[model samples]
Target: MTDATIKTAAMLAIGDELLSGRTKDKNIGHLAEVLTMAGIDLKQVRIVGDEEEAIVEALDALRERYDYVFTSGGIGPTHDDITADAVSKAFGVPCLHDPDAMGLLSEMYQRRDMEFTDARQRMARMPQGSRHIANPVSTAPGFVIGNVYVMAGVPQVFQAMLDTVVATLPAGTRILSRSLPCPFGEGDIGTLLGAVQKAHPETSIGSYPHFDGKRFSTELVVRGRDARALDAAAHDVAAMIEALTMEREGAKSKDLGTGELA
Candidate 1:
């Protein structure tokens, strides 16, 4: 990731089940964390039904906006499966059976002494001018065309495909995160946090608050690509939290001085 431009990506989970609440999505978080670790920023995630137009529209929008677009679902053996076709339409290419993918599926089915039915062969269909993505879990492979990589919806299969694609993507500056759990709430440090943000314009600072029965606490997370700048910002945030905490405690406890200013 040294001397590299910031690379960005987006994920599109295509499934009617996801939209209908029959299935819960787990790939977004996995991909986001993986891409971030790989120095590629995962900018956004979207979910659409298994419709061709919706998939095409989302694909076109995302591919134009980000460096890479990863899609999950709709390339199965069922009749409603249509992601490959939609991707082909978006790229203005034909959908056809990929010989490499067919050979892999054919061998797998042959080894199992199972018939390679047409339905099963649908897994080999890919958009023209696309390359296959290795699937270690299943013999049927995914495809990558242009900046878009179409993969399986199943979590295990999706993870394997991600591992296969990581080596092919460009690297960006690795983002670093530092977090401090503070006793101060958002109200106590809203103004000060704003000031910290203004002071460290290169880093991103976010406040996550939590409360149950007694105390209002927050976790301040600071992120940046530059280690020096990130450490400076994190130090300030910790000091600010400490100062605010002491101020609130000073009113109840004895001889507590005003802590360092943010």
Candidate 2:
């Protein structure tokens, strides 16, 4: 088994529409799930407006802080789509039209019998010395510079680009997660939950509350990369819940409480 180490990642979602609520940001959730499965911890996520300075500052900061940085959006064929330029400026590199990207764009234009104007040609511009990320859906390719991997804003396009990039990345020890649904409200299990977290520092515990009208229920999840650690934590948590239920039963028997044991 490979030595377990936390690999941190940062995400930058660049677009003005997201901030204005014109577009609901769905990319971050998908990216977070994907990164988690690959054992990469998503440390920070930022949604910045379509401003060059703001984007550059965020890019520089995240790239320095995290092991890997991913930016989505602002790679479209529009004047406001200036992610490529901002990225280049952040790294102090010149943005130039990539020959391979140009060739791909030319082929796409020829196939569609469309004229490739300067505006359309702008899609080919990538940071110098950056490798092109294959775009399976659209002609405009994403690029990788150092630890930063730039991807498209469109969901379908971004997903396809991720498939290409993720394969080549180093895989850390994957996290394992297990959830148990209990017929107890969060308020009923609050103290026991805190004790579980305190006991297992390696495992992350989450409580999701649900109401079924007649009763309240919660799904508790324990997550960690180490199987033994996760199992031990889960056992202790279950035991604590059982003990709480027994105490509640005994109290109700004495007319001190009326709620039934979970």
89-190: candidate 2 lDDT, tens digit per residue: 998999999999999999999999999889889899989999999998987899999899999999999899998888888897888998877768999999
- Deviating ranges (above 4 Å) for candidate 2: 1-4, 211-216, 245-262
RMSD (CA, angstroms), candidate 1: 4.2
What tens digits encode model 1's per-residue C-alpha lDDT throughout 1-262? 2233888889999999998999999988889989989989888899999899999999999999988999999889999899999999999999999998889999999999999999999999999999999999987899999999999999999999999899777667689999888887789899999999999988999999999677677899999999998999999998998788778777656634655444
Report the number of backbone clashes for model 1.
0
**Residue 40, model 2: Cα distance from true site in angstroms:** 0.7
Q: By TM-score, who's the top model here? A: 1
Predictions: Cα RMSD each? 4.2, 3.2
Q: Candidate 1, which segments miss by more than 4 Å at Cα?
A: 1-4, 213-215, 254-262
> TM-score of every model?
0.93, 0.90
Clashing pairs in 2: none
